[model samples]
Target: MFNNWSELLPTIQKAFGALGKSNPKMVKAYMALGEAAAENEVLDAKTRELISIAVAITTRCDGCIAAHTDAAIKAGASREEVAATLATAISLNAGAAYIYSLRTLEAYDSLKG
Candidate 1:
């Protein structure tokens, strides 16, 4: 019931450590993928973290939201920037719902026909 977002980071790290102990190879591969993504030269860390935040929101991943928000701040993202990124996510989520509604209506039409 703790609403402390920052505190969630350490908890996630501990869980990840325990998971790594259980399945080392999968964890190692995941870490390597993260490293490879981090090493990409074009976007820079701050932008990536912002994108990660948007993705986490769309995917409804609380752990990702906590970690990426922290990473974004550490990468020098301002509050304004994070808010802007969230706005984009909101727009995209709404758009996705709109598109799916159209598809659902289509299905209804086809079924009725």
Candidate 2:
């Protein structure tokens, strides 16, 4: 982990506080967006937060991982569920890298020929 997940929420609050001091309107907008997306009723909180955690991992966003992991737990996700989400993220990230390497190989082959 990029940071202690336990400290995630507080750290975010602190960071956002600093950002808000500098750009209050932008911070307000961001917070509003988060609230809107999260409060949507189609998916339950647990599932939405679990998906957020997976996307955070896939995107390699440290802040997102920490925040979403905390949120996922709060939303009633089990440790096993988090593990499964992370495993899926890992698999997809690795698969994407492997597939993209084909383009690298193709470039090398073209240069050689």
Candidate 3:
């Protein structure tokens, strides 16, 4: 898993490199958000990491998943905790998708009738 960023495929490396160079102000803003979030007494680091990983997984952002997973581990989250967060994300996402499907089918059913 991203064992060698430097040795990554050229296209991937370029893409990531471009992302790193793209937006200084936005990057700073995100950094500020992270800093403020960390300072929130009600949200411990592990909690933050769990939420971050859940969002990353739901949003299908591989880079984010990697970054947040590492952060979670560093913040003293066990593997089980990270796995549980992912499971919760998957479950909730599935429920949301199913609800949308049901809504769409209901709309079509009404139109058909």
Candidate 4:
């Protein structure tokens, strides 16, 4: 496992709490943004958490993955659901590279032109 997920969350929580104490407004704004995003009713809590986990994996945010994975499991996400979402995350990461490669080609052609 890449992370000791058991202790990672608590350690991250402490680090974030320290940051929040040092910069209250920034932390508050971040929390508010999360709340605002959750206000949208299109996705249920479980789905939102699943999406969050996917984003965390693709973005390489271990803290986010640990937090959101715990949240997802608590939200009643099944093992199958998590597995499928992980696969989606992997595909998205690959797709991003594919798209960037296309953009690289385009940039070269445009520069040559």
Off by over 4 Å in 2: 110-113
Arranged by TM-score, best first: 1, 4, 2, 3
TM-score of each model, in listed order: 0.92, 0.81, 0.75, 0.92
Error of 3 at 61 (Å): 0.6
| Clashing residue pairs found in predicted model 4 | none
- Candidate 4 steric clashes: 0
- Candidate 2 has its poorest 10 consecutive residues by lDDT at 1-10
TM-score (C-alpha, index-matched) for candidate 1: 0.92
- Model 1, 31-85: lDDT tens digits are 9987998886789999999999999999999999999999999999999999999
CA RMSD of each candidate after superposition:
1.6, 2.3, 3.8, 1.3
Ranking by lDDT: 4, 1, 2, 3
| Candidate 2, residue 98: how far the Cα is off, in Å | 1.4
Q: lDDT for each of the candidates? A: 0.94, 0.86, 0.82, 0.95
Superposed Cα RMSD, model 4: 1.3
lDDT tens digits by residue: candidate 2, 4-109: 7677778886987999999999989988987898676888889888889989988888788878887888889999999998898899999999988998999999
- Number of clashes recorded per candidate: 0, 0, 0, 0
